[model samples]
Target: MREYNVAILGATGAVGTRLIEQLEKSSIPVKAVKLLASKRSAGKVLQFNGQDVVVEEATPESFDDVDIVLASAGGAASKKFLPEAVKRGAVAVDNTSAFRMDPEVPLVVPEVNEKAIYDHKGIIANPNCSTIQMVVALKPIEDVAGLKQVIVSTYQAGSGAGQTAIAELDHQAQQHLNGEKMTADIFPVKSAKKHYPLAYNLLPQIDVFEEDGSTHEEWKMVHETKKIMEGDMNSDAVKVNATCVRVPVVIGHGESVFFEVEDSSKLTPAKVKELMQNGAGITLQDDPDNQIYPQPINAEGSTQTFVGRIREDQENPGSYNMWVVSDNLLKGAAANTVQIAEKLVEHDLVRVPAEYYGK
Candidate 1:
């Protein structure tokens, strides 16, 4: 078995910590593990394979002799250091939205488009967390019956925003319970004019709103779904629409997805259930009689995407509806990023290009 030296950027973050855990159980044999983070996070200890690894401040030199880089740092940090890591001979699997839409970079969902990993020029972008699970649930349907459209409404967790948002949700919940004035910060777009509490309430917004009145999170779902499924951002084959909302939940994300098939006569609820039941990385729980269905609470720590409530739209026979749930930090972000690295190794595409080595 060959072992590769791996580096995890943003080692102390929510997703970064999960990456460390996944790597411990991953099939990829790891020769060494390096933990990199911001200056403030340097010296913090994180456990991996039963050993404590100290976090180091990330720099171009950190990629020296590194084979794989799992990057979960913010967009700015990824945009700055990922290229440097690639230049030094490490294949980077990025979790931020930094390079997802770049023509030179491959935005991949392993189950949906594993072949796209080979097209990478030293970097592979992991689709947004929300997009990752939705595509996983829809890929089987798309394969069995050609997909024509996707409309999704997400019930996203506080963890999607970051650790600070998670803490704020908890703090606000306590304040609301005690009849104290709740403080609003780090939510509904922290830089926006108004901040809202995500405790005991839902905010119909995830990221900053675009001029077209769609949130950035919604646009990512719209654009990323096309790129991951069809391999082109401008593909008109599958039209996607998303409505993202931030709920008070702490770990899992749930989505209500309605999809239309090109060949309506061949697709049915029972057939869709059968496809989902046999699909990779998917669990079917569609037993309406027994009240069995996917939920965020039941999906908290699992890597598999839970799908249920399979049925066809009464008004539109061509369209069907299903519910999808998964651990946003694991499968949605960390596990998916690690899976891309594993695919690269499986296909023997792990080596840095000759032109990028040492330059």
Candidate 2:
């Protein structure tokens, strides 16, 4: 029943604001809340649990006396400020990709790998948006039949790119309606030389392409999945590959996941439904008779991961396919971070590990 002082880095952005809302609704004992952002966002007032809190520019001193920090800032900001937070005795859960691949950090989805938090060296990592929902939907299957491979094709929302990309989609949609030439700036990659309109179209690229012809987002899903689902960082036990696409939607992200289990006999649609029926934070919406399935529009605001369109792959005996949907900002980023913070308190493991000092 002890309350802890909490600091939220990047308190004004999309995911940052959702983090605040999740914290407000979470069961963590919050003694005091601090809102930290960039200088441009400083002095902006936001409500938390009905009280107005002004955003402060984040710095090393901002983390003083903070017990927990929910960081949704960009990689640079997380790389810059999280160590300071840990140095000042705060256990931070990061939403950026900064520490997810780090051997020292635990890449977690609460419903899937919550126990891995026990090994955190002060900073726990939230996995990629697509990876988070995929793992959550797969946990039930992994419990029933061991996982061997994960192949996901994501129809992600423009919001996944950021707040600006959402607005770009809106503008382009209107432009298309008016028959005006839609402008392109933020689709494939912000820094890429060529850009494309994301309204009423799909871009197969999420992040920049690597030399191997896979986007960074795809690589993240491939590698991060292996790390989160395996105790061995380099384990090839579970194979993961992703095809990421940016769709016209605004909030929720949808994934078509094809997975192969170790034992085919243990899992069928009925048995998968049985496991999902008892799974934590999972919703089984599979129904082919009346046309029921998970959709991004129906999943926008909720943090729960929805699964539907479950069926066995005709081509492969041991593989199955399902549709997974969740709010990209909530379940994928903000709510997941809050869940980790709650686990930290519940397990009484909030202090920084000694080995992580000056690291």
Best by lDDT: 1
Instruction: State model 1's lDDT.
Output: 0.90
- Per-model TM-score on C-alpha atoms: 0.97, 0.97
What TM-score does candidate 1 reach? 0.97
Q: Which window of ten consecutive residues has the lowest lDDT sum in model 2? A: 228-237
- lDDT by residue (13-113, candidate 2, tens digit) is 88989999999999998999999999999999999999999999999999999999999889999999999999999999999999998888998888888
Q: Which lDDT tens digits does candidate 1 get at residues 1-359?
A: 77899999999988998999999989898999999999999999888899989999998899999999999989999999998989888899999999999878889999988888876778899999999999999888878778898999999999998888889999999999999988889887777899989999999998888999999999999998888887732335589999999998999999999999988987878899999999989999889999999998899889999999998999999899999999999999999999988899899888777655224
Give the Cα lDDT of each candidate. Answer: 0.90, 0.90
Candidate no. 2 TM-score: 0.97
